[model samples]
Target chain A: MQIQIERIEHIVHENESVKTFFIRGVNDPRPGNYLMVWIPGSGQIPLSISSFKNDLCGFTVKRVGDTTAAMHNLRVGDLIGITGPLGTSFSIRGERILLVSGGIGIAPLLYLAIEARQMGKKVYAICGFERAEDIIFEDVLNGLLDELVITLGERTPLDVIHKLYEKRRFDHIYSCGPEPMMKRVFDFARSSQLGAEFSVERIIKCGMGICGACALPNGMRVCKEGPVFDLEDMEGVWG
Target chain B: MVDLSADIGIPLKNPLILTSGILGSSAHLLKRVASSGAGALITKSITEDPRVGHENPTVIEVSEGLILNAMGLPNPGVDIFLNELETLEAVNLPIIPSVAGYSEDEFGRVASRLEDAGFRIIELNISCPHSTALSSKKVIAQDIDKTRRVVNAVRSVTSLKLIVKLSPNVTDIVEFADVAIKAGADALSLINTIEALEVDPYVEAPVLGNVFGGQSGPSIRCIAQRKLTDIALAMWKGEIERVPLIGVGGVRTPKDVFRFLLLGADAVGIGSSILYEDLAIFEDVIEGLEQIMTDKGYDMLDEFRGKVISQILDMTI
Candidate 1:
């Protein structure tokens, strides 16, 4: 695989912790396909293709492991080998859609929302976080979202989702976030009979299909089968 | 009447063997072992090609689990592995050769060599984390047709008992296992690695050359167990007696081994831990099983298979 040094054009701290890396994909991977952004000597890790308009792609990361730790140390012009848009993608386009995000989960949804906006879809968003500052993508997300709600941690676990549903319904619900939050969102969708699509925030290893890391509650691999799923199937995940 | 002792399938008292990849990446390496002792040994995934695998930083340890990989399917390959076997004594312990190949023709060719040259059984690797031009290990295990195609192709050409390795890195493991069995698999290995990855906060990149890879170690065992238990349930529910399922993934202790057997595994493949310990772990595991088997008043290993899991989880009529 070809590796490149993506100069960190800028670092956007969406929350106090999670940061979004806007890297230039050497091979120009599409949104949904992640990159194994290589660090000089530390190691490589998989990051979702948060946004892919040009050769540039976005990766939202919460400080996690060694390589990521090393990454947290790097600045502009430090190069890394990028290896993937690996696995599959739900590069779907539509005019009518509901988009949802929690925490750093908005990265991929931001890119997806960009597509919906580009397509002139009346986009709806439910972006949740712990506090006001923890919310990333507020500015970019605001313009892309037709109907948006930022669910901060003030209320109970799922009170935000209840408020969103209390308002209006849409053709689809696109989502990503913590397991419990996603579980509740999907659970609500299932119980209420909302036609929505959700993606699990899987802790992946080989963006490839081999490792069992991103396993569903039922023991299925989430990498290959999904990052994006509907209520019909999300019902069986993360129990 | 069935000549149970005559069969003596595994001399290791417990029905479970740290089937391949548990220990013994090399004869000298699996020199000693400890922890949740099991019975027997199945070596790591060795292929006919000497692969370099992917770059380092291959493995990443995480919160209850880990994601690692060298892209390193990079084994010594068959020729050298076969050569290495010569200096090695017949591991008075049971040894089933775990072989991986890119195609059926290759799998058959390798199995034929192992059968003629050595090894009593052959475990076929149909799944592994691989690198794509763009990413690493992005593909899920196998589609229905590829699963059946590879299993059937290898089975048709081999006379020795064949064990097809199933991918836990899949949507429906039971469904895939069923296909392999129907295609003539003698035994099945449940759940390979889970596909996983990690990323950096500052650099905004992945940690490995291959973006994502299979996750192994203690954390995955529960998922493995759930899948294994389900596979067992399906086998029992469907009465698939002819095809035996060997449970693997996340087995660290004798109790875990016992649990796997109870959950319905003719044998269990021990991985990860053996990496943390020594090779002779086979002896330790076997010793433990001997005590448990005797305590249970079970005369044979078969008696324990699925007994524990069935009693606990089989809430059916």
Candidate 2:
């Protein structure tokens, strides 16, 4: 796919090192779908679509490396090249859904929460952060989600899930975070017989599948077969 | 009844080769391609040491069916790749490892290791366009002396079949092809991606991380065909040894494969087109080739292989 140059419509500083840039030009991106955000000479990195409305789409980026640090400097109206709404998106299932997010993984889940709320499904979120300052989308999730739980200071989202499972039952689980956290969530979901989906991250190149840079151990290209995969599809991936 | 089996030093069930650097990163991925019906598998270019390669945006699509990439030869080094190769032994297909190095000694050492591991075919990558080079020549294939020395170094260490991959960035690829063959290359695969650049006018900077990368896909097909035809004609005129040739660059369809074979390639490599069609392209191309063969009243590739070259020779005579 050719890169489409989009203008940054607005920018939101979500935290000290994280910002969400809402760009104009993406159309109909689903919750888990991601964009290969290009900063020209600095290079490109895959960013999940954190929010999509009308013709505008938002990407939540953390200042991790060169490309992302450059992205943090982009101002409103700056033109950046994008190639996506690429990869699989989360499949909305059941009347109630639980969102488990760790660190910046809250980006795509926040979008999923908004989408699920609009569909009249009860959306509950368990967001984990290294510190309270690192938390993002707090105000938005509190207002939009049916329930929001923030875990801080060594309390992982997995710990919250284990506790929350005792009080209430969820029909499905959606998670995006560090692999170890997601793997724990996957294990929990399987044991509870809850259907689950996850948005995974990898070193993506040629976001269109041909370059095997983002391929999982099972030979599934994360850029193509999924950035979001069903629990069964992820078998042998972590192993 | 159309038989597509081919022999490029090693025998293959068909002519579709999974070109190096596409999806050759791991054993499972190679096995996945094997299940997709590729005739042979060429691993990603492995070096003596692990290379992290360039930063993100190493590859980009300039246009449809066209890609610009400068992956910088990122690999886990030969030691790690050799373990992956052991897992690939269960694949039951010819797995040709593409070896690259910064020096002649590195090339020989890497190839010698693979030979010791019992691999029968080795594809020497002297054509990577964007890799860092210790030699003055940015790409070894650009310098005939460097290419010959690299090939000879590996040849001296291994009795395995050596396929020297040539670079299209060179002025006369046939000269390099001749030198490689004379230096003991058993076959040739051409052309590696051509050097190119993409500048984003909006950002006022080059698009790729490396600033410059190699171009592949349909855009380079005609250029690759011209280069292949030049070497084919040279072979026809007895200017170079008659060795197997694997034509690569923008081969997406059965007709593209037919054109390459008619130009005297023993087989064809599929690379960038995988971005468009994915793994199914292999099965799709194979079935299409069979249909085309059936329509042409030929049951085997040899009946039509180099047919165009023969006709050209007839016209000239």
Candidate 3:
């Protein structure tokens, strides 16, 4: 099952260590079909495709582990094995779309923004970072987002959550990030009376579903059941 | 001829069990494993009260292994657990409940509740790597007298079998095993997770939710064999074979189980390896064992528990 590796390039957007690897593949890898980069010796970890536009499949990755560390070591000409276009992707369609992200979690939703923009729908992205040092891909999303509110530092995620509550309503909301950060997004979506919101949870192993590893709120293995689930379905349900 | 009824003193249908942690958090997961073909199930370790546990990202994946944990042993209260067991009792599998505490009173109370509920085995966990040290709760198995007192206190209350789970994180595991035996523990279980650390080279950050986690999985096998042999040799020298010792960690297949038994483990507990396969893996391993036994005409498990040496001797080149 060898697929041609399409090159989706990046420009160093900021001083922070983030790069948007614009990728291309046939059957366009959806907004959440994270590619599994097979590092020769380090094995593989799933990296979400941030955006897939035209013929491009983009991965906005941060150096996180050995496999990721290997990704950071790559040059423009280096080729890596990507085993997916995996998991069920984010399928959202509505008049208004709200996208919230924490840190590197903002990567995948970058594509979703481009997607919503193409559909000529209203889109907003409320992205946050641990500190200013970890921000990336802001320049590309600036023009595409209707409400691209970038919050710097850890505390600002909360501040943004509270601000969104005071104003604005979207037909659909999407979030990805640390569990703590996502927990807040779930609450904000519920409080604002936002009807339908979804979350992209951090999942590991058994992306194919057999390992029983990545469990959701009800011991439902996230990989088999969902990496994307309706916020209303998981509300206050024990994870 | 094949039969599902066999007595290993404990009367298990198969040797495989849901060893510690998997769904040990609640009685519900325990019931699931029991139905999944585990001969028995060991519930996650519990304390006296409800705890909130560690913050998120509490679990992490490292190469061939995983590290988890709620720095918060946050369990539902003991009363809640026993109440659940009231339902668990109907699940039709032996529940080897795990009890942990920083103090004797805590362990004693939890054990008493299970004992009263007619639980047969209570595994007292004393080697949690992430738990806070207690003033009065003695790592008694390390100190003979404290082991004696805690064991005696729990022993005095009930007729249930006692098994003290020893931590591999210690220097001399056999020393602790001796304490458990001297304190009248019925049997022993060895080598809890090894305390280890994994790092992310880029961020230079630790991989686990807890900066350090007890390493489990195939990576710990060589240590497990060494630790098992060390404790076995010590117990053998003391002429104390009556206290059955169960070897845990690194048993990936029937071959590994054979090796552990040869190294002097009376029973074997397959841990993380089971995560890679289905729950019916118990029946698979047991069937493999039966085939091995049939080929050698060793009809009963007792005839082959540690017969690797005997088979080698009987073979002539």
Candidate 4:
């Protein structure tokens, strides 16, 4: 796949350190599919598709490092190179779904909520962040999801999932976030015997699976086999 | 039944080698490739010290089956890598650790450690085209003296089989192959990705972060074949000592493997094609090779190994 230079049509300042960029060019990317976004001088990094509507596609980025910091500086009409809609997307299953997200991991899950709701699946989400400022897509998730729970600081998405488990049940759970938090979610799903999928992040060098920089312990290339892996694939990986 | 085994210093069940630097970073990944039906596995080039490598945009697909990468040999360094190697004892296949360094002493030190760690075969990567971090901006394989010195440095420290991977960017690959062999290389794998650059028309800047990266994949197959044929022909005509050759670059099919074996390669390395086909490419190519062998009525690789070279020799004579 070649890099397609697309001009940023819009930018959403999600928070102090996170922003969502809307660009034209990504075609029909399912939720959980990522794009290798290239910032001219800084380099390329994979970003999850936060939103895609008609011709415009959005990438929500957290300014953690050089590439993302570069992405933060980009504005409307600035051209950035992109190659993706890559990796396996989340397979919407069951009548109801719970999305567990931490920090910037909420990006793809937000997209997932929009798509799942359209298909008549009841979407519930537990979005966790280090601080209130770190939280994003709150209003959007509230409008789209059947129920949205925001967790801050000591209270994690797992804590909410544990609390919510007593009151209601979800047919499926999807998580994206820091590895440890996702591991907790995966464990919850495994123990609960609920079907679940988690989107993971790695040092994705080539974004095409050949580089192997993003390989999980299971020998699956996060770029190709998945950024989103089902519970079975997550065995031993998180365990 | 058709056999696909070959002995390139080490006996292999097949001739498909998981080329160095694709997915050799960790022991788990290596173990994964080990089960993927590869005859042998070469680790990512391990340097003396950990290298962060180039900034992102380190690799880009120029087109389908063509990739440009300048990873700058980012490795966890030999010490940490040895820890990973310790777990590979159960992997079952020949695991060759590829080593790289800035100088002869560094090469010797790294090779000696791997030797002490019980690795029997080492692929000296003196051909990384985009390794500008080396003291000399130019790659070692591009210089005959540097190539010989590095090979000799490793050879002096360890009695293990040294497979010197040479650069295709050089004018005469046979000369370097000769020097490396004379300097004590037991086997040879070629050619490393050709040095090339891709500029984004819209961005008007280099595509790769390193500005220039090594080009690999199906597009460079003809170039790699020609380079491999040169050294193979040289060995045929007694210009260089006969060492097992690992033909690499753009090998994605049974036909590619057949051509490499016919031209005089004991094994063929699959690197960039993994980007397109994943680990299954190994089985796909091997199964196709078996099919081709069955159709051709050949029971073993030796039946047609270097057949093209022999044909060329016949015509020349």
Among all candidates shown, the one with the greatest DockQ: 4
Give the candidates in order of lDDT, highest first. 4, 2, 3, 1
User: Interface root mean square deviation of every model, in Å?
Assistant: 12.1, 1.3, 8.7, 1.0
lDDT of 3 by residue, A1-239 (tens): 12123333543334446766655553667675676554433445667777766776677768766666666767665555455676667776667887888888887787778777888988877888878777777778887888788888756566775566456667777888877777777776676666544545653543444333355435444554466677655763522
TM-score of each: 0.53, 0.97, 0.62, 0.97
Which ranges in model 3 have alpha carbons more than 4 Å from their true place? Answer: A1-219, A223-225, A228-239, B1-9, B65-72, B86-89, B133-145, B234-238, B278-280, B308-317
Candidate 4, what DockQ? Answer: 0.79
DockQ of 1: 0.03
Question: Cα lDDT for residue B228, model 4?
Answer: 89
Residue B8 C-alpha lDDT in model 1:
22
- For candidate 1, the docking band is incorrect
TM-score of chain A of each: 0.84, 0.98, 0.86, 0.98
Candidate 2 Cα errors over 4 Å, as ranges: B133-138
Proportion of native contacts kept per candidate: 0.06, 0.79, 0.00, 0.77
After superposition on all C-alphas, the RMSD of every candidate to the true structure, in Å, is 20.1, 1.6, 9.3, 1.5
Superior candidate under lDDT, 3 versus 4: 4
Give the per-residue lDDT digits (tens) of candidate 4, residues B50-110.
9989877888888898889989898999999988767664977999999998899999999
Q: What is the TM-score of chain B alone in each candidate?
A: 0.83, 0.97, 0.86, 0.97
Q: Which candidate is the best by lDDT?
A: 4
